[model samples]
Target: MVGWLLAGSMLAGACTASSPEVERAAPSGASEATPATEASSQPAAQGSVGRILEHLEALDRIAQRNGGTRAVGSEGYDESVAYVSRHMRQLGYSVVSDRFDFDYFEQLSPTRVERLKPRKAYVDGRDVRAMVYSGAGRVSAPVEPVGFDLRSNDHTGAGCSSDDFSDLPTGSIALLRPGPCYYRDQVVNAQEAGAAAVILAFPEFTRATGVLRPTLLSGAGIEIPALAATDGTGVELARSRTRLRITARTRYSPLRGVSLIAERREARAGDVLMVGGHLDSVMDGPGINDNGSGIATILEMARAVAAKEPDAPVRFAFWGGEEIGLLGSTAYVESLSSQQTTSIEAYLNFDMVASPNFVRYVYEDEIAPAGSDEITDLFTRYFNRQDIEFKTIDLGGRSDHGAFIEQGIPVGGLFTGAEMLKSRRQRKDYGGRAGASMDGCYHRPCDDIDNINQKVLREMVGAIRHALFALLTR
Candidate 1:
């Protein structure tokens, strides 16, 4: 999954619910006891937790062989694609590898920020850090705070609009608060106002002890540099009218990524039930649990369903460049013709389904398209039948489903948890450390095979398998 922070507001109103009991017989040839659900009538397909773990082990070995990462633009990602595509082809599914290019940004050297008038050299990575996609430049200018509401703890609308910069002097460094809006908007507004550089400050109430690293997402047409500072550094710069010298060194290049799509060889044209997950991991880790879990689950489901075609055409996608953003999925959605887009009945996304400290989370129906409630009910009913407690999470544009949702396609999925800390109530429900992050190794080097919770992984795989069978047969 992408390393972006999960929205805190979404968690506050999360609902934990259970449905009436429904029994489903376990599929044949499954070693572990599977949930008995409404879809048990479709018994031709069988799920294997062992197969899922085997897939994960293969991905781990691939990552280990290729610098411990399956990140986009790397050999591991390419090998991952080869692995999945080979399996799909061997399973008698016709596969296509779609390629797309994106702007890749890398920092070439340490960024420097200095208080020129006070002769104070601010430490990089502590006082301030260069934003991703920040332009490389050196500038010395007086700082100007734009649209900052210092008194209020609410950090929103600052430098988000160009009107906020109307009176700002040209060549001045704009100091602004991180927003309800994107860092891209903030930097663009400052650039349009002829600012020499941009600095985004963490909210005063934020508990961050180090510099905040923000991303502009893209470097296309951006000329001036951008940086992020701690709350203290921001307040001092805003209050003291400091003249600052900023230097940022970065490189932007075009890179290609490929997403793999597979469907039955003899599949007919009709409404499609699309299921997918990002295949790429963050550069910091092998991403076994971050997404290797999702990939493994879906791959196993694909294998199970390969024996018999469903009533509706099913397409399986292994997306690329999701860690950088939702690049692969977004591009795929954009590439589809309007008629093709509408032909997609719904999408099921599985990302980060196995966290050490876990919760059985269903994507909240409120944020999804109209028919999504049915999809949500499908998983919840399965969980209820199995006597598993589940919560609804509002994942607003945080995963591959975001692309499908943008095209008015109903989307639903399963997620165990991510970087968010598990609550006391969640701990009671799921039985893990309450104060610890759901996935302690999220986006880090330690997110290897051992980072996974096999119990949650097996359960989630079962849930996903149940949901897929239910969707296909319904």
Candidate 2:
């Protein structure tokens, strides 16, 4: 999931409650505060990073054995589901899979871009990649500049406005550049302009590694074919006088994802506290840090919590299809009845918790559900007591928490970082490169076990354990 900037006032000393009130403590128990040192050194907490590394290694193996990815509908993802569910069952929890259908995309053939007039074909993976949600088709037409004119050497942000299409030729592929709008908006504008297709040429700064890495449009919908081109290819296409032939074809079919849910044995029927993380990864990589870290941490907490089975029920959810959007989580939330919805005391999400270049982040919702502020405070206080620096960032509608928030269920979570670059201040606080992305390998194939920061993983996992201990024991 993409990251968003912080917003709203910092959570104050208290927050408003919006959901049904949960009993302060289970009928059979009274909550007690435990020190971090004591909470983290327990047997269950031993080798937190070691255990996380093991899961990361296992996920890497699954990806290696099954086409190098654990993406939804793939064997790797299925095996991953089985792995998590099997372990939860062994730990004496009732495990179940929630199945859902999502629009699945697979490239039928390598996408190609040829400058017919110039008689040159750019390298496929290096120079261009078909946009993940682009339509399956082949088109041969003149490449008309839309957002920026080559001769003028000026960016008009053309595709962002419909007026830019005034003199556009029908049946020509529109060429655009990254600017003030989303790729979807550009594509939609081009589609409305009678353009047969669209190509978004990356600016020099975005051409990391000089490759046109594939980009995706929200699976929500798109009718025209779109492709991402390297800056060099864009320049070449723009200067070439002849038409271009773009062939892009992808197979669209039904894809199934399974979310594993485990509830402690014979717990109370009152408010349920749901803790979850997405288990599925992007198509290109093993996704160790993007989500493997979150799941592994949650799994550890689940096992420890199960060993001491409390009166209040706790549900652990390992969501699927989060990479495409919050499909799995959304489906689960939509399945719940109004009563079931209210029965959920609070929801905590953990995604990308262990980026190599990391910063400890707690999701802070200014206007949040009933127990969200408490959750944030729990994390903040834990880090503070440990002398570890942390920050409260806006949730930004990015992960599984989004689904719960949509239903007015209080939600909070942790995120080390994704693609966002770290500032000088954050670097000083976190001790990482100031200009680098917190998770440089995010969504890339290199996000294997080696991409994790063991120290960050250990601290984050310890905090996760502390939070769970607080929720279950309280």
Candidate 3:
């Protein structure tokens, strides 16, 4: 089914930058942590970066030992929690597990794939499996494929339009392509057009579908079942006007998750440095590289700093239910007292810091935030130092960072890209191919230690170290 394994990888490409109105200059008399004066020293205050890596590797091994899925409420998730909790206890820092409950769902049936026309057309069952969230309901109408925009305001059936849909006879399904707007929106539009059902197609090859969870819903709020199918699915159904009977029962529900919070009171610097990664994943694959890379990077950074206790205490978290709807982070931030909100100086988030080719991107500024500007500049300087190439992208809340940006904190971070459809320009920028992506098995189970790029891992370690050192040591 359209599993969460591919979970939010599109978030990397789908991100939208928040407001840029906040002045970046350090207020004339504000207190802020400076860069580590001692990058070279094995300072106890900055948790042992090396040891933290070893610990992360251990967690990796243990998680791999269990099921591939490391979602917090699952077995793999529990193992990951145990790994981190054990390490935190040993580090001499105060640790508190903020427990919360969430409604959770696990897939039961294997994605059902069938062919009504034996030799004439074989169906790729995966499409029916995908778009499952927007995908639910049954369609017995002989599949009618129309290639065009599913216009707004109304629908009824194949070739139906806004006004056409209002009069459309019942039991009709409309199929749409991936453009013009959200895949979810296209489906909603079709259903609005009076379509009893809808099909949103994804790129054919990957056989994967992308999801869009807006704060709104269509179908008069009574959503007609919508599904994300492969573009190829439409093609096969078109080869012969065979009646294509389809049924997709997908679902998206509210799930509660847990988050851990720790406080180290540095002077009331009037700011907080926050770093974290989501702690949940879809039911199919193990979300290792998709996030193990990110979680490991932040935990290590926190452990290193907690050991020595930097000038300013850093708040490190491992969020839950991000795959579902950014639940954990959203809940935590939303629960904060409005008065307790503005104390953050900056938020430096890390997600998928390691990739095969390691093409780094700074997720913020033309010039990074002052809190992280030096670090961004340092990244460029480092690449220049190593004759490497990198790029900068707009700040986006596709990850846990979204929570902080909603709170108006200057946010930025390091990422090694996600299932990006590489461009011609990108092809010339690096190797593999201009159209080559960072990782194809982004949210899949194959994204384990082997999938990780060691060189990329090294770069992530360096980037995290530099940013933390600069934020806490200076």
Candidate 4:
């Protein structure tokens, strides 16, 4: 149970020979192709990723003046789980915020998008954003503009090529326009995209996050449901050519986040460098860099690599409702136990590695495991031996190291994107604007701390403290 369960440490790199069974529910632009490094080894070699992005910008100024972080079941997520279990028990180690009790939600008010009949209208949630598991009450129906309302890729029935919806009917309300899937693949592709209920517009005028606003319709077998809207209410229901009647009334409540599994026993523990982030955020936005810069770079690199002295025994995690879907690193790697998943060997992740237009990429997944290709060849050999500028993307599925890469774990790290889309090769290597979105305040509420970029959050905390001081010191 607590043994090193290795299905490749729950699938990390080499992505376990292409694994993509089923997990597409949280995907809405997460920008970053990679480029930008060297935020340390200067000004006094500042150590541990510049002392962990100044504690991930002071937990992004305490979720930008309180509200954007520690969000799982509020009390600002149990006071950010007693501020990372009192900073990993003051660095001595042995901390655990692990107290599982999910079914928490908060957005107490505002989420009404009516537009009944041949006239009348409204919409909010800071304009248009709702998709956490989205499915509650109040819906008048009659609308079905199905352009890209996606359930998972229904480009609109017998036309968008086809995944078939048996010819959409029964109370028709399905409509979509977000892609690359997940959000229950637009609610199982709008109930198989045949539609009878669904509405998720946002082809252009973007920026949103809201959905999963339920009150228990079904659980265990999990079916969250869908009922969203925006794209300026689909540009006022496409200037109303009539037929509109969509009502909306999403209120939410499903809180309970507690993930903390601390271990620091080095005496040559070797090949077991797993890190963590996601101290629950996304409610009035307390997610500093979409993860308070991955729990301030794994709690200040688990207090500077357990005080710069460890050859392995570094497992400082602190996840809980990783904004909903990575459900605490996939329920702690699906509660591991397959021959203890092969006495693990590699898994160095640091979700949302400090933000501010992060680049200096990695994760090509080159059959990943020679200890994570010697850790992305040591950040592609320290950003091409310090010439700086990054980009290497390709290992899809976003974060919690994609649940130890779905159960194989030979993964890698460094991310500064969310709600992504900035290309043209990331504006010719981290230049900004070639399609803008390296986190345009990712989970909105203006992803606070004045939407960071402090030199791309100091080269994403010096390429994650020089890739954890070269993978936990050799």
Q: Return the top candidate by TM-score.
A: 2
Candidate 1's TM-score: 0.83
Judged by lDDT against the true structure, how good is candidate 2? 0.73
Q: Against the true structure, whose lDDT is highest?
A: 1
- lDDT per residue, candidate 1, 154-269, as tens digits? 65536767888999999999998766566778788899999999988764222334453445767887889988787788888888878998889988899988999988867677
Backbone clash tally (model 2): 0
TM-score per candidate, chains pooled: 0.83, 0.84, 0.75, 0.33
Candidate 1 Cα misplacement greater than 4 A, ranges: 3-47, 64-68, 114-128, 141-143, 203-214, 229-245, 308-312
**Model-by-model lDDT, in order?**
0.78, 0.73, 0.55, 0.55
Model 3, 1-474: lDDT tens digits are 111222222332342121221212223332333334423422432344455456556656766666766755677777777666666666554567766655444333433334456533323344544433444455666554555333432221233224423544456666554443334455555666667765544443334432322211212343565554555665565554355455545555554456766555542355667777765544455666667777777776765676555546577777776665566777788877766666766677777776664456766643333444555555554444444466766543667777777776667777776666455555566555545556656666666666676565665576666666666655
Give the Å error, residue 391, model 1: 1.0
Ranked by TM-score, the better of candidates 1 and 3 is 1
lDDT of 2 by residue, 57-157 (tens): 88888888888778788888999999898888887889989988887777778888888764888666668877656777889999887656676654434
Question: TM-score: which is higher, 1 or 4?
Answer: 1
Which residue pairs collide in model 2, if any?
Answer: none
Task: Give the candidate order by descending lDDT.
Answer: 1, 2, 3, 4
